[model samples]
Target: MIEFIITALEALALIAMAALVFNSHRNRFLNRYFALFLVFLALWVLCGFPQALVQEPSDYFITLVFRLAHCMAVLATGIFFLFGLGFYLGRAPGRTWRGSVLLATAIMAFCSLSDLIVRSVSYDQGRFYITNGTAFPLFPAFMILCGGGGLLCIALKRRESIGPDRARATYILLGFGIFLGLAILLVIVLPGIMGSDITSDYTFFLVIIPTGFTAYAILKHHLLDVRLAIRRSFAYLLTLIIFGAPIFLSYMIFRFAFESHPNLETAISIIALALAVALSPSALRWSNRIAARLFFSGLYDEVGLLHEVSSIFTSTANIREGLAAATAIICDALGLKQLQVAIPEEATRGKGNWVIGCVRREKDILGFQEVEVSASPLFLLHDPMLLDDDANAGVVEDVRNAAMLLEMRSRGIIACLPVRGPGGNVGILMVGRKVKRRALDPMDVDLLHRFCERAGLFIENYLLSSYLLSMFEELSETRKRLEESDRFKTDIINVTSHELRTPLTILNGYAFMLQDHYERFAEDERRQYLTYITASCERLNAILDQFLTVSRFQAGAIRAALKPTDLLELLAEVKAGFIPEQGRRIESDAIPLGVRVLTDRSYLLLMLKNLIENAIRFSPSEMPIIIKAEEKEREVMLSIHDFGEGIAQEELQDIFQPFTRLEEIDKHQVGTGLGLYIVRLIADLLSVTVDVESEPQEGTVFRLTLPHA
Candidate 1:
């Protein structure tokens, strides 16, 4: 009867697990695999139920059923192994590995079809014996091969690629090891010692070992969201044990009594039934009490309550709410009449310091009191509130004063704790005695101290949260101002482009007309017109290019085609194209001709052109603009030196910013204020560094450091 009950419960659990797997099928792979395993386990249990009920030897029908069940279990095990391997690979069984799974499944199926796997079976005295033939060795070999395949697949995964999923693989390997070890022991070692007759019952335990491991793996790893299923199974098993055990025992007792006394059988059975019925409520209550006491002890409940209090403290933004919640928790936990928390007046007055304020409480019993001070304001002034000989003096005086006041009223202090936040001495917490003449115990003091420490953390967190919120508000306002400024800059660039283009076009047209018609005029007139037109057109084109580059960079449309090119060649091209004034000498030292670098050649050329143009525009007509290059460790350094009115120290930092030009320099040198900005942007994209050194009334040197090829 007991075996039947166990089988029934196992079956129900299996069905429930199946339903869960089907419901969560789309969500988890492990559940589907484990659910199939449970189905086979349930069938295996059912096959043994009839034999257990009859207390008889096994028959051909039962043997056939058991063999089928074993086949199912093996197939389920193999599938689970493959699924575990797939999980490690971060994919489902793909073409690369699916053949292995199919081959293993086919081998197991063929083995099941051949009777040679378990040649013969016999039973005696509730023991079933199975004789394994040569084919039996192949079964173990097949299992080992499947397990090896899983291990190999996992080993192939790159070490860096293996993430948290490695833990699931470990679980799978462990479960397989346990299952395989127990199977071998039962089939080979146990039968030799205990004889084959004892194999049937022991073999069931071997199967259970692997099943239990699989269940644990599923629960711990959430391998298919099977944790909920496991939890529900536990709950169901507990419910059955609690409600079913007493009734089952009572029924057995009544049956024994009736069989022993035939004359009084009916009466005794009725009395037993009546007693069981009468005790049902008490039995349930007792069971509930026992279970609750085991699972939900008072200490556990208290811990849970403390956790809830902690959550409230952490989640709340209001300081007053946190303080109130803390006070309530302490008062309730300690069973105190009143709890008072005080912050030091002096601590709050300082910029970022906090001191323990004074804590006050009323004495009870006709409003009379005998007050005992736990901590004082002076004690908190030391920050940590250390209770030493030197620090205790002020505390002792405050206690004396409180005692005097209490002598007039009549209430005693229970305990006092100093509260500290990150900034130190945030407050002091005090609890009054529940009854007159009662003093605080060691446990009370410990609890209060812990509560105070937690309260301190909460207060500190609150202050930090407030500070963060203020910072966020300031950042939001700053971001808004920046957005508006950027939009205004864009508008100014658009208006300037239109305004500058019209005048430049007319100037170029008239200059070109004079240069063309000057054949009938003087040679000097033609030369002057050509120079003016060329210089004006070049300046205008430079301004337009800077603006276009800046807009493209800001819009994230700039693309760099990087290749190995000589820096000297690129710089030379820029110099030859952008001719400086006649009297302004441009000089280049003998740079390494073939020093190749990997960068966008066009952007590099543009950057060098900007530097040379800026130098020539700012320097005096007769001064020389020098370009030099030298190789450093892992980098090539290039410098463009200008003998110009140098930038001021205060303005050096702002020189690279857009629309920022030297206030003391020539105002007539038409520039869009974007040349330096574009230069900096291109350098940044190439992972290069740009630095400028200058002194007032001297000269400025712009340096570029590029990674050496």
Candidate 2:
């Protein structure tokens, strides 16, 4: 009778579990297969439950019941294999595998019903048993093959799966392995080895263990996602354990202790009931806590999540670092595989548009890929978007959005939430599929929405602050440049005025001398005065010419007219421009004739003149300046070598900058500091390469390389 009661309860529990699973996901193949397996398992238990109550079962009705029970067991084992395949694939088993299962089921069912498997049913020694036929070994062999194959599939899934899927696989594997292995042991292995039928009666009773695990996995690990059922079941179970344990314990103790004292037993039972009632409030609190912790460990309360997110973003100054940290926390709290943040490339100043902030993979870090979808379009979504149920199709109405979603899905992203600021949408917070592969529930979406909102505000404020700080820095730099310009202007006025005063005064003095003593002076004396005036005027004209060249350079009015020219002629023309004293110091003898380059004659001439003049100004009076030209494979190299107090290394790089003067060199040299600056400008326009090498007290050399014509 007790066996009958337990069997009935186990069958009913399996039926209830099947109903829950089937109702949880009516369309999913995984759910359907698992539920079908449970239903068939319940049938097996129900049909076999009567075997325990059968005493003299040698009739046709009793034999039919026994055959039906074995047939149900065979069918249930096949379905269990199918369920394992579906669970492993996360979908229905393929047509080939299903066809094979159907074929196997037909053969197994026929053999079970006929006398080939179970020859007869009999009652002996207060227990019921089946007499095996010649083919009875096939039944146990089929059971081993199907059950072991199912366990192998589940084991493979557990090894490969991550997060909640791994947990589910583990639970199912444990449950299935324990019950199936025990059933095989009791029915076949032990019955043959120990030579006893002692454990056969309890073999079918073990089905409920795996059934319980499957139900738990469905509710707790989101295997089928009957979350509400999970909560209620936990609550009821906790209530039973917390409130009923004490009362049941008291009754058990009092029943034995006060067998003769009925009055004392009644009083103690009443007191125990009162104690249970007194503890109900605390028990209820604990029940809620345990349920929440067990099933919803990956989530926090909305307010707490919001507050924590706010703290993270507000406390961080760097946008990328902040997003990374926040996403890491959020992914952990929400059980996500990866969380990505996409902002406009413009806003990040060309850093990157997508920040793959955090990834929660198992054991291996996922490789980061550049986001192919333009983030500009994603910002258009004002609300959060969940991808299509198929996940291969798009959920949005627009074509572009659909395409973007397709691209997103290709990259493993399943959801996109807009991060909007006061102005508008600023960024997108993208999440990949959950680690557990569960659908995004309302609580998850709500938390993500709130997180995006906070992120938008934080990013907006941070960008605004960055913009203001950049503006302040720009203003500060502008002020510094203005100060530098003012100093340059003052220096230019003082240097030019002093340079012009001497030349002008000399011209004036010579003119007055020539005018006043023209009749009394000799021809040689008047001619000398005229020559002095001419030299001073030329000096003035050269100064004004330099000023004009600098003005034209600043106005971007310098244009080079190119032509082929002889290097030797160019050298002569540049040398002739210097006064006799400077000209006499320069040597241009080391040039090969017929060496030519394509260049602007005027530009090349001016560049050479400036370099020669700079050489004359820096070198000692007695030292000779050598001008040389060399023909190379691809180019012609012209060099002006000066033996002078050479430029310092630190000052060499800055020598081409306008108004830059060497501080360590002789201060007596007279000219605007535009010689090298003009050479550089003309060099650029003429496509000529200019290089300088110098050493203190050794000499300086400026080499100009032009392409050979």
Tens-digit lDDT track of model 1 for 382-463: 3322222212223334554444334313333444456777677666665565533334432345456667777888866766
Report the lDDT tens digits of candidate 2 across residue range 369-414. Answer: 3444455555344464545342332225667667667667776887
TM-score of each: 0.35, 0.53
Prediction-by-prediction clash tally: 13, 0
Worst lDDT window (10 residues) for model 2? Answer: 386-395
Best by TM-score: 2
Judge candidate 1 against the unseen true structure and give its global Cα lDDT, from 0 to 1: 0.62
Which segments of candidate 1 are over 4 A away from where they belong?
1-531, 580-584, 662-666
List candidate 2 stretches off by more than 4 Å: 1-316, 328-338, 345-376, 379-395, 559-573, 579-601, 627-639, 649-654, 657-669, 680-693, 703-709
